[model samples]
Target: MASLKTTLVAATILVAVAGCAKKRPADLPPPPVDNSGPVDQGGATGPTTGAVVPGSDADFRRSVTSNTVRFGLDQYDIDPEARAILDSQSAWLQRYPNVRITIEGHCDERGTREYNLALGDRRANAAKNYLAARGVSPDRMTVISYGKERPEAMGSDDASWAQNRRAVTIVLS
Candidate 1:
């Protein structure tokens, strides 16, 4: 009777341990290859083969001339410099039709939260409108206002304030 009981206990533990074993999943296929060549906003081409994935943030930053545009103090207008940057961004968007983006408007630390939020909205919308006018579909872009909550530069000086007041474009796949 003792021998039979010991055998039964060992069998139960072995079965439990075997049931807890991890199972391996089937292997997945490799990602598709892109044969198209790399092109810049200026119509210039670069090395055809690289590790930069398409519709990725790295690709967007590498392809566009500039992703962030600065604004004047208490202003949200698209100046000549900002316009040029947006032009390049629009071209990049045109190239990647499926990639969506978010334009974030920011403000200096001097303004009230409410005022800064409103100003930020205006800045973001200004950028979105510029891209839309350049033939980018409005549906592919989103606008957001960070106000003074997120600052690019940290300081009370002119340089920090100048850097803080801007609009930034983020690539969203």
Candidate 2:
């Protein structure tokens, strides 16, 4: 009787351990391998493998020189520098016909919310118009004004204010 009981207990323990083992399904594919080595940029490792995924934000950033444009104080006009940046962006947009984008306008924290909001709208529209004139479809883009609510820079100095007053383009697939 003792021998039979010991044999039963050993079998039960073996079954329990076997039940808890992790097993992958044989039909599932193996995980993708990363063949690209690490790239160093500004003390950070930027891993860029072959071919950016199509219609992706990474592709847009890789193809364009910049995704942002700066504005003068209380102004929304596209300067020469901004125009150059928009030209690159427009070219990238034309390449990816299916990708949609949103242009967000921002302002320095120096004006009332209402005034800043209005100014930001103008800035966003200015960028949109520039892109449209460069052959990108207006329907592919949307604009929003964040005004002083979302400042890129946190300080009140000239440099920070200048940095805060800008328009940023966001890629939305």
Candidate 3:
């Protein structure tokens, strides 16, 4: 009887231990890949597992000439300098047709939130239009206005304001 009771307790403990084993959630997605190194100009990413994955946002940004284009204060027009950058971006977008992107418009801190928001919108649209005209599909692009909420450079000077007045292209997928 004593041996049988010991055997039963051992079985119970084995069952409890089995129940406590770690289980991977079936609904969870795989962990994201790290992409901090310099971009490969070739533009392809992910291993050859037969599973296709979109390129990382950072890689896409580095693959292009510039991820951001500067704009004149209170202006949404694409200047010559901005045009060059946009041209490069357009070419990159053409290469990665499946990659969707968002253009974030930003303005300096000199105007009211409402006014700045409108300016930012115009700025984002101007960039989007430029890329669209350069053969990138409009369907792959979206726009948002940040107004003065996000600034690349913080200061009450011309240099800082110039940095803030810009359009930044962000990869979505």
Ten-residue stretch with the least lDDT total in model 3: 28-37
Residues 42-159, candidate 3: write the lDDT tens digits. 3345556423234547566666778888988789999898999999888778878888988888899998999999999999999999999999999999998888888778899999
* lDDT to native, each model: 0.83, 0.82, 0.82
Colliding pairs, model 3: none
Separately for all candidates shown, the number of backbone clashes (residues 3 or more apart, or on different chains) is 0, 0, 0
Shift of residue 92 alpha carbon in model 2, Å: 0.5
Error of 3 at 94 (Å): 0.8
Alpha-carbon RMSD of each model: 11.2, 13.5, 11.8
Residue 96 shift from truth in candidate 1, angstroms: 0.8
How far does residue 75 in candidate 1 sit from its true spot (Å)?
Answer: 0.6
Of the pair 1 and 3, which is ahead by TM-score?
1
By TM-score rank, best first, the candidates go 1, 2, 3
Q: Candidate 1: misplaced stretches above 4 Å?
A: 1-50
For 1-173, candidate 2 gives per-residue lDDT tens digits of 99999999999999999999999867742222121323222223234644456656666666687778999999999999999999999988988888899888889999899999999999999999999999999999999888898877789999999998988887764
The positional error of residue 129 in candidate 3, measured at the CA in angstroms, is 0.4
Task: Put down candidate 1 lDDT per residue, 1-173, tens digits, no spaces.
Answer: 99999999999999999999999988653222221334233222235754567667667778787788999999989999999999999988998998898888889999799999999999999999999999999999988887898888889999999998988887764
